[model samples]
Target: MNDVIRAPLAFRNQHEILNMHHLIIGAGPAAVTAAEHLRKLDPNCRITMLAAEGVPPYSRMALPYFLVGDIEPEGCYLRKREGHFEAQGIDVIYGRASSLDTVAKTVTLLGGDMLNYDKLLIATGSTATRPPIDGIDLDKVYNCWSLADAHRIIESTNEGSRVVLMGAGFIGCIILEALANRKVDLTVIEMEERMVSRMTNAPMGDMIKAWCEGKGIRVMTSTQVTSLADDAGVLKVSTAAGDTLDADVVICATGVRANTHWLDGSGINMDAGIVVDDCMATSAPDVYAAGDVAQGRDLSTGDYEVQAIQPTAVEHGKLAARNMINGNATPRGGTINMNVLDTVGLISTSFGLWMGVEGGETAEFSRPDRFEYLNLQFKDDVLVGASSLGMTQHVGVLRGLIQTGAPLGKWKDILLVQPNRINEAYLASAQSQHAALAAA
Candidate 1:
């Protein structure tokens, strides 16, 4: 951490004397993970979790599965057993944080209730972004973010229901299968030139778009939704291309923004998200941030960035919790920017700097006819990034090679020539590194 005055201790624990009022904001994966870890660290710590949603702490990612009828509402919960939080001595309060007073060590809720804490964790995750479109606030327009949104989508969406999805980003693509499962008259609008333009390369994105279209989805790329109009109960979607489409429901899968507006005057540093050190500690003393709301380190770039994936959120929460009790004991090395999307039956994945860093070399192999593509990015002798489509077997190895930063040495040259030899390269590089470490 930073040089600052250490807060006074309320009591002494087995390891150290410390204040035990560990309060966590948000009820997503990060919040739940931190709360559980906090309990395991300090059984007697006064742990309270503030939830913006009225329902139980559940996985937002599971909302798509719920929409597909693969799982019920209960399956979306972080803790399934009755009184799980209570049994673990964790208090879950439903409220949105309105303001924060770092000096007073208190957080004011939207309902005007002030909660004081000795150690606070701001895991307040991201909120779904709503684009500036006319009639976007209409009754049928919903962002598939919360459980409530899922329920509304389930109720409104029926067989052959005309659903216009506004955005072909990761979140939008995730719910594509569920929407397809409903067999609705689907149309996906993307402002980019191809699907998942942010995550994958143009070729891979185009392949995904083609696959979706093959599945009977109307995919419109390089298109913009100009406005929306209410046609009685139907939604009239107007695009910048001067096209009007009738939709029963408009699912706004635009994107998400960090939930850090409340901390504006709180003096906490923020850049894209609440900036945090390796210890997950923010600029404020005794306050930490994690998950989508925290701008942590990216392993590939060594720069602070907000990784809104569930895996990163879990890691952030765990590390933040450990550091909270042990005083910045566990420093987060960095998080690999990765995303795996299952668009209908086709799978696409990207790891680390998938777009390839400046001065980096890239090896590509595309077989569009067979719906297969692979791109490997290398910097020096290290595998820094990779992207693959319809190649599920190498997903784990690709992620491992990028994350481990194993020196490929000669394998780098070999991979450049034969990109499909990723498995061999991973094994050779990892084994060499392991052998070297063992000898050391």
Candidate 2:
């Protein structure tokens, strides 16, 4: 009788192993995209997503529009349809992963629930970096990252409110425009030498600073907030430059760090982020990482780096999902360094290695009077990178040319003389390539 009972239990355990489970630990675009693809590829597989925020998956990029009153909170949802996740059979569990056990293939949530998986994806994304400063924890000071934070900001801020924005990096600059729309007395402070120092060159940064000033927004570069204090029911922001400003709200957009703390001692190789191969697989077996958490290859530089941009995230998700199901059949092309900024009415963009590589040539044109500029970087006759200000016409062409790595032949010389003729060059180069292909 004992042997008969043991045989039945053993058979049930084997059946459970046959049913595959794909567990994703995030709720961002990458996470949702991967889940959807996984279901499409393997209809019978068990798909579960761990949403740490305990809310419906929403786009952080859309939060600014929410702040500007352009969209309702529901509009921020990645899938606005009712029962979207349910209809797709993707189970979303509202729990934060506290620890990962790669060998056991289990993740422990904060509430002490251990979930097992046949395969795992780490798409935990990132969190806003908060600098250590006195009174940094004071009331009304918040990082406008999540839905909860957005609610606090909306409640604390109003028209004519005194708002002090810290850091003028990519995230900060994005939030700046929404604040400006709120008609608040806004002041932007950056520790870098110029605005968006990492993404834009000196001339472009200066132009943005000047443009913001012209719009009546006080732009302070090379300035850092030293501390914050409560001043008669208002917030006091003290800067490193010996200046203090009183504010109704202090918005900290300092920076962001990858959400990889839970993977410590999990034997996963990580630099600034989890190092991923061409297939988006991590060092551990049966484990993958994607989106902002995975530092993969840069197509232009051929280096592994975290792009943290939406395009990169979405691409990473699709590639990761395909490879997960198809056994490394879909390797990533690479993640491009890309940014498109809209500061008030001025538009600026950068692609790939915008800050020219060594021994590379460049073609540039600028009309500071009209606040328009274009700079193109090249290696031999191929366009490698580009930057532009207040010009929308050449965006699609510039990206297409650089991404395709088209040989310009004589077009390179023409661009050096008249970089403004990028449109013509693109058309000619494309026609020539088509002709060559037809002849071949």
RMSD of each: 5.2, 5.9
What is candidate 2's lDDT per residue for 1-440, written digit by digit as tens?
00101111222243356768888989899999999999889877777888887678999989988988999999899998987887777877778888888999999888678889888999999999889999989998899888889888888888899999998988888888788998999999999999998778888888989999999999888889999999888999999999999999999999998899999989999999999999999999889999999999998999999889888888888788888888887775687888888887789999988899999998888887788889999999988999999988758787777777789989999999999898998998855465543332
**lDDT per residue as tens, model 1, 1-440:** 11111223332233233547888989899999999999898777878888787788999888889999999999999889987887877777777888999999999887577888889999999989899878999988999998998999999999999999999999999999999999999999999989988788889988998899999999999998999998788789999888999999999998999999999899999999999999999999999999999999998889999989999999899889999999997785788889888899888988998899889999999999888999999899888999999988857888778776788999999999999999988888875565543332
Point out the worst 10-residue segment of candidate 1 by lDDT.
1-10
Q: Which lDDT values do the candidates have, in the order given?
A: 0.88, 0.86
> lDDT for model 2, on a 0 to 1 scale?
0.86
User: Which pairs clash inside model 1?
Assistant: none
Q: TM-scores across all candidates?
A: 0.92, 0.92
Query: Which residues of candidate 1, in runs, are more than 4 Å off?
Result: 1-19, 431-440
TM-score of 2: 0.92
Per-residue error for 431 in candidate 1, Å, reads: 4.3
